[model samples]
Target: MPQFSRHSRRGRILIAIGLGALLVGTSACTRIRTHQGYQVDKLLVDSVQPGIDNRASVEGTLGRPSFVSQFGEKDWYYVSRDMRALAFSSPKPVDQTILRVRFDPAGNVVAVDRMGLEKVANISPMGATTPTLGRHRSLFDEIFGNIGAVGAAGMGGGSGGGAGGGPNGS
Candidate 1:
């Protein structure tokens, strides 16, 4: 009957609209995964041997390192991170790897060390103001405190005189 068909059409349209809304909502909340820094290859990493592999061989195998030590013995660092984020939130590290290759004076590999997220440190700043050792002054005190300090007493100016003594320096 015509009445039955009309109701069926309406139900189908409502179902389609509901499905479309659900698809969009889920897409918005989908997590975005990203990789940063060096990409490690297990086989290549395993091939590198201490003493046997020199700086040139290691560089050829792993490419350039992320950073090198600034002081003390020369060391190369390969840092990697896997991050994930949802919606408009900032990305957070899901996994991290820090590979350190130590080198001797002769540029030969001394040791190879690998570290995970356990070594990561989180630091939170105390507040907006930095703690400093000094006397605290109010707004009014800071503004007017030094008003008369310019030429006052042993400030190296006015009354007590200049280089040769007196006001004329004679």
Candidate 2:
């Protein structure tokens, strides 16, 4: 019978641990890509004309204003917020703008200013919490479009509109 050395066993154990670590590390590696966002249209004094830029044009350009000046209607605001999942990451308003476009009685693109996030107040994590919005329609009821109906095994599958956008926006 052949006797194996203790050092050999230890070496085998070390090799197994190394291979396991390599496999685990390789499996964990993944790639996530971020696509470029659309152009952020904001008020630029030199570019935007006050009377030329109306509510429709403004909305068409920037989608929607984040906020409007409480003091003045002429002054519009655009604010954007983003929260990083990393621990202890400071909550930040990634984008903000004070659309300062002063009009001379007529609604023409007057002098405008594109402010940075500094214009808006930084929101702390402790601030207001977002509330959960319940589903508009139950899943099963949507597909079937039946009143107060539940599907097999409580699976909400139907043509009706429900929690999820089924065939319709329902």
Candidate 3:
């Protein structure tokens, strides 16, 4: 074999180190993360028996519901969701569950319903442009909209206290 120069060997080592570091950095940047919401324990939820468990017992078991019904106080909802996403990407829902517990007028649990991701609905907006009452102005209109609206002295009645001639000006 042929002997390699010290400088050439050092350069090759540096290049290998740089390539290794680049691979590590890129892999770290593209890492995916899993996020969870509302630690809803299935066992605890199951332990809550309808008609037997009241609002107090249910709350004690599965903790408070994520939110109550907007129309009435008889419905309680627990929302649990798992999201996964890569770096710099919007999180996508991997799993979701909505636990609905209906209470009777006497505050006793009447019904328990568990809804899974199958019930998830992806609602897209009707149009890309949102409906607005006023007219939409362009970038040029915005930048120059107030250009002529102001006077050379800045605020019209200002005593030449703008630009190069202000209270703190030279």
Query: lDDT of all the models against the reference?
Result: 0.91, 0.55, 0.84
All models, RMSD in angstroms: 3.5, 15.3, 12.0
What is the Å distance of residue 112 in model 1 from its true position? 0.2
- TM-score between candidate 1 and the true structure: 0.81
Worst 10 residues of 1 by lDDT: 155-164
Candidate 3 shows a clash count of: 0
Worst 10-residue lDDT window for candidate 2 reads 30-39
Which model, 1 or 2, shows the larger lDDT? 1
**Tens-digit lDDT track of model 3 for 1-170:** 24568778989999999999999988877847575657878888889888799999988888878999998889999988887777788777888889999999999999999998898788778867878898689999988888756654546754565466765775
* Model 3 misplaced regions, further than 4 Å: 1-11, 34-36, 125-128, 131-170
Please provide TM-scores, in order, for all candidate models, with all chains considered together. Answer: 0.81, 0.39, 0.64
Candidate 2 C-alpha error for residue 151, in Å:
68
Better structure of 1 and 3 per TM-score: 1
Tens-digit lDDT track of model 1 for 1-170: 99999999999999999999999999999999999999999899888899899999999999999999999658999999999999899888899999999999999999999999998787778989889999999999999998889977887556765677765888
For 36-145, candidate 2 gives per-residue lDDT tens digits of 23335434334456557765565666555556667656655544343332333434444443555454445444556666657666554664766569866678767878
Name model 1 segments beyond 4 Å from true: 125-133, 152-170
Task: Give the top-scoring candidate (TM-score).
Answer: 1
What is candidate 2's TM-score against the reference?
0.39
